[model samples]
Target: MSPRTGVRLVTIFSAVVLAFFLFGDWLARRDAPEPLAWYETYRESLWQPIQDRSLTLLQADQALGRGHLWMISADGEPALVSRYNLESDDRLWQAQAVIGLGAEEMESLVEAQAWEPGIRDQPVSPAVGEALGDRQILRMSMIPVEPLELNRIEGTFGSPDVRMPVSEGEAWVYPRAGAVVAVGEEEAFSIMFGLRDES
Candidate 1:
């Protein structure tokens, strides 16, 4: 092969590699979920119950098998009692107890827990009847709540529990205006707890 031909081939290969890298980077950034203010509010609200119950957010990986954003322990015994996730700038969460703890305590607990080690695991659906609250709560036995892509609304359910005939392995649950949400069949939809005004 001639030196000129070799140099031209090398240049073409470099251009292709550069283009691939640029395209991958742009797609990753575009697919990233949007930041949500409600996530902060909802996180604080969910942690309130744990603090109120005197449970501590463990520094260990408490939620290994159980799929949830945060995990807490009462008396050093870790239990997956709460669930939280962020989708499309919206927050979804579900807890065993109501979230009405004092703001100061919740804030402090959240701050302390922030420094704790994170638990990485696949998202899991909450168990049936585990999400007890004042309002209506249902379990999605058909669909399993899996993470969804940014701005993608496929296989998602909306707020207000409406009993309608759904195909097997397909269900949707939307978070109410003042309710707690637990991941159900899809990341976009989750099992919602009853609403309680903080004020």
Candidate 2:
């Protein structure tokens, strides 16, 4: 074949190959199942009751089988925090809860256990449990089983009510939902609920 004809033939072959691959990719994407939404997954999980302040520190411990506990001040108020791990489908998921403690509760905790008030994760003493178990959970945060991309969140929920720069990520807060999504450079890593109300 002539050089010109050979060049044209090569270009046509390349174009056909590119078109074939593109079409295949499109078809594959079209046939793929839609991924579960982050909110839906969260709501269906055992952590749902925590969002409505229905779960107490001790109840959560019983349900999640006891996690690491910490005594810390949240917004200038004494609070009890716990972290739990859930193993499912060979993957590990983590959740955290912050329970607001009253001054009386803090006094009780201090008197009952050897713990000094500070931000540290320590073993939960039976005395501490008895003191704060019934305290209402103020916030719940979780690391999802699957990574959630930042764009997907914005696309689904629109602009957040509050967007602020946080350590290692940006916090996207939705006041009406009382939720905050911590988005890193690529994807969202953590989500928290019960931060605020619609009003």
Candidate 3:
């Protein structure tokens, strides 16, 4: 091709490339995610266990309502719970034995007792429910209850008459003001655990 023609083609190509880049930037700017306080709260709640415990045991934050966020470890170990109140930017959580125990502790427990997940599986029944402190705890047969997600009385707080089930599960038990639920911009909801129904 002639030198003049070559120069013209190169100039046109460069202009097209520059225009595409500038337009792309503008498009991205328009479609970017908004910076919402909820998002920041979500991200902050996600990193709590990572900061307090090990990231390897990080689990899914299943509960997201009002303004609070909850996450549970897969192994039914202690869960990383967090409550985010946007009104005043308040956050709280419980990181110890939320589900089970640490990996090392769990390993030791299993090695010492020959206990493990599914080593002995039993249907969740009302008797078991009573043991869990919920006298009315009805065992919804085959209701898709994850054995690990089920809540039980930890030896730490349960009665001495009944030995705590050395297994995995979770209890969404909260007192009147334990689980904070923020609604809209100003409303709030709270739950408080009362005396265990022994009936």
| Candidate 1 Cα outliers beyond 4 Å, as residue runs | 32-37, 40-199
After superposition on all CA atoms, how large is the RMSD of candidate 2?
7.7
Candidate 1 — worst ten consecutive residues by lDDT sum? 135-144
TM-score of each: 0.28, 0.60, 0.24
Which candidate leads the pack in TM-score? 2
TM-score-wise, the better of 2 and 3 is 2
lDDT of 3 by residue, 1-199 (tens): 9999999999999999999999999998775533323323534343333333322212322223222222333364422223323231133322211222446744653454444443442222223212222111010001111121111212112222322222232123322111211112221222112213333
Q: List clash counts for every candidate, in order.
A: 7, 0, 14
Clashing pairs in 2: none
lDDT of every predicted structure (CA atoms): 0.37, 0.70, 0.31
Q: What's model 3's overall lDDT?
A: 0.31
- Name the top lDDT candidate: 2
| Model 2 agreement with the true structure over 2-120: per-residue lDDT tens digits | 99999999999999999999999999878554443445555534345655567777777776777777666555545567888876424456778886777877777655555554545
Clashes of 3: 14
Quote the lDDT for 150 in model 1. 21
